[model samples]
Target: MVSIIGHHLINKEEGYQILLYLDPQLIEVADEFDESFQNKEDLRQVVNSYVKNRLPDLKVTVIRVVLGSLVIASIPLLPGTEIKDLDSSQELNLKTEVKEVFENTPQEIEKDLLLVNKNNSLADNYTPLNLIVPEVPFIFKGFHEKKLMAAKAATALEELFAAAKANNIELYAVSGYRSYQRQEVIFKSQVEKHGLLQANQISARPGESEHQTGLAMDVTSPQVKFKLVQEFGVTKEGQWLKEHAAGFGFIIRYPEGKDAVTGYQYEPWHIRYVGQEIAQKIASQDLTLEEYLA
Candidate 1:
């Protein structure tokens, strides 16, 4: 009985590990191997095939047992996967390996960490996976494409918004996801109104925009008249977000003085979800995503 476990090191120092234990039945015929002997292609194919067969009903529970408590990561998993108890000794060993992976090696970039900038552009036909509208107050009144965010980001945005509300700070979603065509129209308008140079500073050109990634959201407060402006950074809501956004897996993508690195003017309203651990690291170090990646 071999258990094929796929473990992603979320935060090794904190012992945060996300383990996906594929049901033995799912890969019963595959050779028994642990994390040390990962066959990435084979494992991906097996899981993907199982997911493809299920189609629309592929909701799965990923378990994270920390210390003696069971914590759920609330992300999808392959069906038939069960949570196995990891004794204290097994957990300690797992944490050590995860820590080594976290500190010693560079892993593939995740979707949440996808970078879209002037230099690194997304394809015209590129669309994010798992885009969904978050349940939060929006500046606009009707359903629009801008209301959508990637599923994971949407969940984090909701949590951030709720935290703001709990503290009596009102935040409104200004813009969420944007398609390449929409971004093109926006860029053209900006260029026509502000000329090419200024437009390039204030807006992104088509595929170069982070809004197309579905992981960024432009947020504002009533103080800023629900507009995306630098003044929003000084508002109470904005200040609150800067200090606490990372706690909910978001970062103020563009800060006051990093325009040279980010290739844009400071946009304090634009927040990108990069997961809690990375977001905290970026915020703590005061490094732009480009700087962090570099």
Candidate 2:
């Protein structure tokens, strides 16, 4: 019959499980896992093949356990360690034990996020932003203040452009992941154009910027020069993006009236990729990333 003794690997909820059976005589197993197969060992090679084809990442095992007179086929649950030379417990002892391995898995991983710090990693960045990039017609170059973007930004941007076209929205990446030096140049240009007073209202200092992370974008419709000014957001396409961008794992970096904490002015054109779930929380609560993090 069908058994549940195997890894229950899934896109959203993946982990380990076990399932097996026993017979009355228990002297001999009617079937033994091909070692090449899994919980569905009763069928044939096709069973293992099916799971392998569908889940290239899962490692399956079909084993036989003795239950007094009957021998049953089962897949036993175990820790995340290798199953080879298993010596922790005897065969009959495993029948009544259960361990919550996946439940024990940590919710977040520590990473080295050099942009935020030399160490910033999330073991589980469960932010659900549906922001997948699609194919694009062409690529365009952008500048913030007056500096070039990173290669990663250019690549990710091409995907955004493609997604915009397929979704029937006019979108473009005006500026993308930039560097400290580039940001310094941009900060200088803004100081020149808007003067120091107005410049702080727009441009950002080098180390204090998110664009350096290669996961943000300054965008607009093709009609605009990728500007962070007014008219861009009022456009139909801009308005649409403002309403639905978070669904795609993106967030409007700085919106109206949060400049006090953002350390800058409201910029409708700036979008950051913080994954979908995290971005949604940031958007729904009227919180900037800086505020949310704080």
Error of 2 at 184 (Å): 1.6
Q: Which residue ranges in model 2 land beyond 4 Å of their true spot?
A: 1-160
Over the full model, what C-alpha lDDT does candidate 1 score relative to the true structure? Answer: 0.68
Taking every candidate in turn, the Cα RMSD to the unseen true structure, in Å, is 13.9, 16.8
**lDDT (Cα, 0-100) at 5 in candidate 2:** 17
For model 1, what is the alpha-carbon lDDT of residue 28? 37
Q: Quick one: best TM-score, which candidate?
A: 1
- The TM-score of candidate 1 is 0.64
Q: Which residues of candidate 1, in runs, are more than 4 Å off? A: 1-110
* lDDT digits (tens) for residues 184-225 of candidate 2: 688899898889888766776544456655567777776565
For candidate 1, lDDT tens digit of each residue in 124-148? 6557778899999998898999999
Error of 1 at 279 (Å): 0.5
> Considering only N, C-alpha and C atoms within 3 Å, which residue pairs clash in candidate 1?
none
